[model samples]
Target: MDAYKLMTIAAIGFFVFALDKNQKKFPAPIILIAAGMFLAVFPYFSSMELTKEFIFHWILPALLFTSAYQFPQDQLKRKAAIIVTLGTVCIAITAVMLGFALYAAGQLLVGVSLAGAMLISSLLIPTDPVTVVSILTQGNDKHHLAETIEGESLLNDGTSVVIFSLFSGYYFGSQSLHIGTFILDFFYTALGGAIVGLLISWFVAKGIHKITFHVYQVWLTILLAYGSFYIGEALGVSGVIATVVSGLLLAKELTNKEEEEEKELRRDLKNFWGIMEPFLLSIVFVFIGIESIDFIQMDGLLFVIIGFLLSVIVRGIVLLATIKSVKPWRKSYTNGDITLVTWGGIKGTMSLALLLSITGQSGGSDDGLLSWAFMMIMLSLIVQSLTFYPLKEKLGD
Candidate 1:
């Protein structure tokens, strides 16, 4: 909220935009994060902090809505089973497996509690598809693999958050874990959120149809995006799911409508969101970079390395299972597709937001967990994202 901080971020955004215009191959996010790191170490900006409210309440809703709105509905229908499997079942599998693994590691090496280990595992479970989607869709070639990744990422954030709440509640002794209760809670939140999103989008689409002014239509679209999220949250459901469903529903309705005004409204909405997406993404990556300094101070390099490897292994196993169990009607996927999905399970803003949410409950021993989470995020963004392009070229044949 500081003026100087705002100016610095604006400057970084402009620099990234310029690079994007001229240096076609250079990844803008990488540069933004690197710039954030530079600023984080510099005395003037070193103290700048990324708050949970700013990220979750302000930036994330827009990003999530835009990503979901842009997702191809036809492709999503084809890959829905795979996306749901990875988003829900796979997340639960990874959380439990990784939780026990981290518990063992913590017990023998790091002195972290089992409950704490589970909480950390829950935090790391959600994958951020932003970097992976960008890398995969950089060219004209549209593949099912990209759609699957994007769909899973869109849906999994809400699931992971619900799971995290369960783990956090148990860890903090606020609630006991009951399997029946967990299942009920999960379905209620996820399904309720979807319903809320659908209803809001339906109403918003109707309103937009009546609007005579293009500007008002555009603003209405934006309102639907954020409104679905906030309304869902207020009603005690998953806001992420609400926002995603709303965006997708709105997009589908607009696409199916044949009216000229509806078509014009769709075009304007797409242009508006397209412009906002990069600006918001740049800010996120830069904040990630600047916040890396805290991650460094937390310092659990050995644990983080082990945890990252464990995450990769778990994701690979899940992908293999998905490949084997895919129904006959679904499109057959190659080993390359499985490998890409496994490695492409990147963690970003959602994980950070979850981590920050529990900072108050960590009892001053969460630094190592934070470090591990941070390292995993960085590895996903840098190493996995950069390598996937070449890997795709070699294996995607």
Candidate 2:
């Protein structure tokens, strides 16, 4: 697609339709997906390909940094326990349960392997609430829930990526995964990434404090976002986790300096990143739809549907079990509220992004794992998002 044509379409689809309050119930990805699928029939729109390198190197870092910094530091501190458990423990357990479940169901699912099933399970661990956070923060009480919803994703995104990375190597025949080695490696990678991000971002913060020019300050943040990620990856640590940590620590540093100039700097940074994230994600989602036609196989829809069901059941069961340990979740939520949380955990961009990445690394795409993953994501987004409003209304705050 032509750049102008794509931008025009994204603007109309997003700003005009997606940003409308009435359409808040629907995710912007659905709109872009429809538009991309509609445009896919034409040859012009068919040529725009989304490469894994572009997404991981550019888009992922920016989104992680932007979201992390914007996340309130105080809320992160207040809800640390709940957030940590949900992100790490909840995701880990769900991934294990779902992975094993998928592997067991592989008799019906043609050519599916235990490794592929495990990768798919891990990839789906991250959730994207696009505009649902706005709906979640209707009042002061719900505001806490909103923060928790978004906050958990920030950390779990790293956990998800780490799990995917470990299993990806094993799936692709690049490296073998030993359980003992994997457990130790995961901790070292995650913890090392955090330390790297904190160290780099601390220096970046000092630089920001010294610099008076908002333009340079903004550019420095951009560097931090991408820099921390690339640097962490170079050191064989988790880049995703590094970027998240960099954003959080730097954001806390920036937020502490409440001077008028610093405030202006913050505004400028927000303005730049706020527009960039949606626009880039719009392009990525549209590309997902364009790419979808190739991956769609009618014969496998039943199996995919079965897989989706398994995913939901496993995630819900794991969440209900894991969340009881967190006092906030126990105190603030009933069974209905927990149902809403499970429903709201609709796999979105991160899931699809991770899914699409398979073709780039794995030779076979795990024998139609992409197709299975693509459909599973679509079902999750469409069913969960559309039903979310009804659930919200029924459950009440």
Candidate 3:
């Protein structure tokens, strides 16, 4: 099957799924992912192999830019202290915990090597919950929890990417890892991407305000998003950060003006983003399923169990630590708030992207890793994402 044909089928399914309300029993991402895995398992279609070029060049840009464009600046700033602190420190702490947990778990039961365990741990660390959250939480009462979770996930995605790069470099022949280098890598990658994003967002917002033609203005935002990621990466920074920062900047820069001109602009922006979001999301899940076909054959059942347990333990430890930090704010955190944050860290497309990006001998030995990563991601999104509401209600009760 041709790539275009596969995409066409996915697009058609996505459209049909979107139209039916009763069939909306499951989120589109979940459906697309399930469809992808089915396609991979059966011969409904040929495997949709996701190449490095596809992930690095196209999908990453789409994912990041979309993230940048839709990010909520006010909410992010409102919880800025919590977001930054948890996003950065919490991710690092989780990564370390994941590494040790995997190592310890393997030692106790399965007995995998340190590098293999760490590799699996590193791949699952970046939480991608934007798509999951949008589908799960469709109301205002859960807004605060959603905001913090989304904000932290966005930031942690970057942090995890940076950590993965450091460990990968060490694993390969890039350079020996050191504290100074890690700090430098994180600083430049995240900060540089954000600065570039802000700069581009400022100009793009101004350009949008000036343009009478909505189409042109929308294209400008799209161009800026794709362009900023490459530019940030070229400058030795984190493309993930650049994309997010750009989104953050756009959120801050664009006001919800009801004037005719502003309203038109808002409508155009909304339509443009709206069209892109689901489509990108659909493609992401399809890609995951397509890629999973190649991976499912490579590993055994134990890998999946180890991967799933490692992910849960690491996530549990991270949330437990976060709760401890907010111990002082226990009165304000409310039992509900803490529980929501703990449960809302659902992983999705971002994990798939990173897993798909890995290649050659380093990842070759760990062929089962991607399959495990996908399984863990599905488990997190399904179990944690849905249960949070009940958990919230219980806490409130």
Candidate 4:
């Protein structure tokens, strides 16, 4: 048995659940990350590693599924236009600009293609909802701002997955990739995943109608969540998107029902996930803390710093350009809200997990890039997270 898993559970039991039950004063992510970092000093943890296969295949699907299912559909529908634009279009723009910037810099990137560099940086683009939302709830979160944040993260993370998958295929796969091929692939991957997810969700919904037992319902949904992802992957599409789409639609279906039994089932589903999400999240963040140290060092510090700056700066600029120029966003959102949204784009577990999974595929050769991504993520968490509350206070709802 791996002691890392045991250690993570202990840390969650003691630090997360016991001490920070409210998580108002000290958030779980920060606490778990600190625990992981503290534990990393031991000799045994120095060589600890989590494979990309485990992360992508096992952990990724569950985390993606839970977040998607729990996300409120009303908020997504209301903010559909802005959220979709920010999540997809802005993300694509930021990725391209950042990729070009890195390519132009010509430092820290060694023989890596534009797609490869974009793949590394795109992971940083999707802000962590759990980290931001937890902090927001501690303050005056209004205008469904917290939901907006969560929705943005959920949508953008899905977009990030598409971007990562597309780039990964083009950069690594044996094919003569060109602009036309890339554009076509970008659509195919995303649309393909959506179709797969919806079909599975429709079938699952039909099954859910006939099921009476709560336990059986939960079991079936579990299958749907993990199953959608596996099926999408097997079908040569995007599993990440599939899991998200299925979970989102199915969750909405459960929540939208007016019947008492449906409501009770929703409660049961919520209770199950209420326990499961945190357990999984704690392990991921703690593991990030332990594994991140190996990726950070003295030489790549400049590149990491630059990468972090570019990520933050580019995101802010893109948001400003996108929101201010657009008529609907300009009227709906104030400059202050934009500021909050921009600054609140705090990177957490999602970024690190995606990066780890990406780095895991390359083995030992891209340690420099891996270290750069890790360091940049640390900067986002430390600099952005610690300042998030005070920033929120200053920019009142």
Highest TM-score among the candidates is held by which one?
1
lDDT of 4: 0.76
lDDT of 3 by residue, 90-195 (tens): 7887776787777776665555666556666777777766543563356557676667777788788889888888776765657775778989988888888788
Q: Which structure is stronger by lDDT: 2 or 4?
A: 2
Clashing pairs in 2: none
lDDT of 4 by residue, 127-166 (tens): 8867667766665544466776777777787677766656
**Model 1, position 252: C-alpha lDDT score:** 88
lDDT of 2 by residue, 24-135 (tens): 5565667777777887888877777776777888788998998998998899988898888888878877888898898888655665788888877876677886655756
| Candidate 1 vs 4: which has more TM-score | 1
TM-score of model 2 vs. true structure: 0.93
User: Lowest summed-lDDT stretch of 10 residues in model 1?
Assistant: 18-27
The digit string of per-residue lDDT tens for model 1 on 1-397 reads 6887877787788878765753224567678888999988787887887878888888888989998889997987777877788888888887888888888876776677888788888887888776667767765553667788889898889999899999889788898877777799899999999999999999998888788999998898889888998999999999999999999898888888888877788788889998888778778888888988878644566777777777788778867876677664234766677788888887888988887776646576666666766676687677776676677677743
Please report how far candidate 3 places residue 320 from its true position, in Å.
3.3
Error of 3 at 304 (Å): 2.9
Answer with 1 or 2, whichever has the higher TM-score: 1
